[model samples]
Target: MLLLLIFGIVLLPKASTLKCYECSSDASGSCKDTEKQCPSNGYQCAALRVTSYAGASKVSDINVKSCAVAEQCVEGSLNFGVSRTVITSKCCTSDLCNTQLAPAPAKSTPNGKKCFRCDGQTCSGTLNCEGSEDRCMTTTVDVAGEKITMKGCASKVMCVGSETAQLPGGIGVGLSCCQGDFCNSAISTRAGLLLRVAPLVTWVMFS
Candidate 1:
């Protein structure tokens, strides 16, 4: 068990992205006016990180409302107030990046070559290769969300599990491709370390 735990700890660093959560709404009840909102009435937005595993990050949004009767003459059911909340996730790095846990590529034929592709908020693209036994033929990865794309002979291929530009100071890292940690990290970490330890854990846990 201890060995498994240690193995997992080692693997954790190989994860592609971090899982974070944010509130889309709150439960402050109802408010009479914007001024009555928690901000004005003494309230703040809620922060939440749902999960951070397998190089993935998630954000959750919650609602908050506040309400009160301004006068006794008003009808019992006449008063109702509400507010909206925005959900956001934190930047996932180290293990969470284009080089790790990238979104699955949608299967398609580009330039008469078969490949995978994926599309989502601020991102879209495809990957193809010249026939079997040949290196990747052609690949296109565009991250419009981050205003970038990988094309031409140098185009790199990978998956994206989460969008980075959505996070603070992460737009810069959005240019990467591939999944499961950056290639550099994978080479030095997964290939060099995690790969070495995974078998031992499997042996101890299953064997």
Candidate 2:
């Protein structure tokens, strides 16, 4: 049981990349004057572009839209076949001298893109989660059938218990072992108080 409990703690699912969005730009023609910020303000150097994919395949003429800060433009680019698409026609703020032109539109095939599983339509996440906290928690999970033993200096007494739960998919089981020192201390203190009162009550009744 102890071995199985330890195993569960060591094995949990870790989040990983199931799919990724590919972006590109087309740096061809010259530019004149474009808005460098969002017309609504509070957003500097914002841009949006539409790219039409055209080719001789099942994944032909796929239109993609992307936007980013003009000062910090993050466009996507990928070279699949012969055609090198371009990303153009962006909306920016009034900061022309600071905003660099958006990257060229490019051709990107959603080879591993997943279809939306919604009521009407299903779409993958448009933006990536880089600094997400959930990603950090998943990274700490360990593999199944691994042994991990950590020794810590516990204070007071130790109240030990074990809990087990069914793993996802019902493929296996999981266990969580917990030892609380505060609980043990509380139990001991209550027992001492009860013992002290028991003798006094017995003596009063007998006298």
Candidate 3:
């Protein structure tokens, strides 16, 4: 019985192991077909595609597939006038489930919800929210010592999820989401933005 118990314990870990495809590409335009074993902490295999648009012209597309945390499987879009980024991610638990490539995100039609957006140094323009984008979002990130801010419409998955909490930046970035029209118009200074905004995001999630 003791030998059998030890054998079962050893087999249990192997039973939970998953194999996933792992590759990333931007300019190459395709992900290489490479297989990898998922780490013990990884719960799912994911395929992701990111499409970038400048005005009405498509600029670039990125594809990635790998072992992913369950929380990173959310699919969403963010439109910021001059540039728009859309991400589509599919997740599965079975081994090699991410072998299929994620499809390109489709463009969405206007849905009547409006929010403030930025254009260069100006943040007074309005953006029409589309599809599942029912929330207004403001993101401030420090890039190479320069503060960059963007405001736009965002999907609910982008606002309230483990994905947002895991965004790059220990405490230097500020991200806020609100439901009302143009509610993301005003943001605090860089020094206090992250501190003040993180708590406010919880209220937005519940409201």
Candidate 4:
């Protein structure tokens, strides 16, 4: 009887669920204190802050706390001419570990790297890359029947094969990264189609 009880105890599964706070808002608002159990695959608690800027002024900020996958713990920024978006994420493995807010994004100065950027109908202007931004990037997003293209400098982490595989846009978003100065200068229709096709296909299959 004692042996049977010990075997039964060993056979029981260990608890894998994590409890984390969950909230998302476009404005810089407070997160609720309530904690909820995370899904089985969600093994980490994450707190994130995303700030958007137009020119030199901040336009919007988003704050979120929730269960996350390991891939979601990336930190990077994207500059697209008139607008820029920066993301900062903090992650912990323990339950309810994201009780505090993530740290704000650090300010960066120009680092002498330059890349071509799109402005209206022209792509003749150059943008000075800042901080760890050593790569050039081009992004094409097709959301709600509107096609928008953005090209500028990007950090190494935000480039190809890094943690930030896809951006935060909802659907039909495509991103391509490359190196060299003014690498993203040309944005042909065929190139745009190629960049956006795979993501659009994935979205179609999933949705």
Candidate 5:
């Protein structure tokens, strides 16, 4: 009876985990409705959509569905002059709950706010902030002993819990977010926030 109780206890958590659809739009025809059993620890079914724009023309849209943590279900946006990216996410606790795509972000209009963006090694190009992008953001990481930096505008949600959101680059990120124009001109931030948005950051920086 004692051994049976222990085995039941060990199996209880696994039995309660949810099943969720997992796929990405980036992969050709990858959005087929397939499900994955999320771990019983903390994961929930998630759906995320990312939209990018260049000036006035729509550039690309990406969608992903999988298991997510509580922090990953958030909305955020970024703008850096002629380029902009918006993110939206949803999470549910039921099996196969991410059957549909997450909502897309609304179009952003300029709010007269100003920030600095990087061009090559120069970090002085004035960028116009838009919509909920009320904060200036900058990310720095050491690449081959050279610190590579990226600066731009971000929504408050993007900055929240970011210090603890460590992206998997095997390098420390000097992530900073502040209010006011050119606040990112200096690379320091009050550590506060989360959303573990790895794909969004990578797309913004490399795309």
Candidate 6:
């Protein structure tokens, strides 16, 4: 029994650890950084990019390379008429595999789906849902002690559990998702415009 216990303890650690590139940049381009050991087991090397747009003009683009869990390997987007944020990622299981930055999200046209979005006081404005944006979402997050709510179109991937935990400051967000046109109703708020044009970095999309 004593020999069995010792053998089990000796084999507790992994035979080989995973290493990945670590770069957290808010700059609007590719970034490269030195490799580092993954924080823990069950991690993958990941390269992620997030881009923000004001109407049709691009506003900012950010990139990150680091260790990520399987759940963080997804891609999603949030589109409000006046503003939008698209997240794209590439993940690999080997060491130092996150060398290249993630590519930009593809251009998607309106998919004929419609959802309500907030711009000013009332959240009654209609927004055209785009490519893969088959779901309507409404999110309320606390920022600077004030509760801010924003409604718009989103992909189903963004509604999955814990996948979007890093966006919009990572604070607890009251989120609701549904399918069909105008399924997400408007919630009146004072921070409508504040959220419509909020910067992506200010939301801390990457840790």
By lDDT, who's the top model here?
A: 6
Off by over 4 Å in 5: 26-30, 118-123, 140-149, 160-174, 186-207
TM-score of candidate 4 to 2 decimals: 0.76
lDDT string for model 5 (109-172, tens) is 7888898876544667788888888899887544446555667888887774662243122112
Q: What are the lDDT figures for the candidates, one per model?
A: 0.21, 0.22, 0.67, 0.66, 0.66, 0.76
Worst 10 residues of 4 by lDDT: 198-207
Model 4 scores a C-alpha lDDT of 0.66
What is the alpha-carbon RMSD of candidate 4 to the true structure?
Answer: 6.1
Cα deviation of 80 in candidate 3 (Å)?
Answer: 1.2
**Candidate 3's TM-score:** 0.78
Question: Model 4, 43-70: lDDT tens per residue?
Answer: 6888877776777877666677877777
Candidate 6: segments with Cα more than 4 A from true spot? 1-12, 26-28, 142-145, 160-162, 166-172, 195-197, 200-207
Stretches > 4 Å off in candidate 4: 1-14, 26-28, 143-146, 166-173, 187-207
> Candidate 2, residues 1-207: lDDT per residue as tens digits?
999987776553222111111133234323233232222323333232323222232222222222333322233221111111222334443333323443444433343222111011211112111111011000011224432211111111110221101111111022111233211111111121221121110100000
In model 3, the worst 10-residue window by lDDT is 198-207
In candidate 1, position 115 carries an lDDT of: 26
Q: What's model 5's TM-score? A: 0.74
Clashing pairs in 4: none
Clash numbers, per candidate: 51, 26, 0, 0, 6, 0
RMSD of candidate 1 to true structure, Å: 24.0
Superposed by TM-score, candidate 5 places the C-alpha of residue 88 at a distance from the truth, in angstroms, of: 0.7
Sorting all predicted structures by TM-score, with the top scorer first, yields: 6, 3, 4, 5, 2, 1
Give candidate 3 regions above 4 Å deviation: 160-164, 167-173, 186-207
Give the alpha carbon lDDT tens digit for every residue of 1-207 in model 6: 999998877765554568899987745465759788876788888888878888788888878888888877878777767677788899999989888999988999999999998868878899999888888988865676777777888888776354665444442235578889999887788755464446433344445
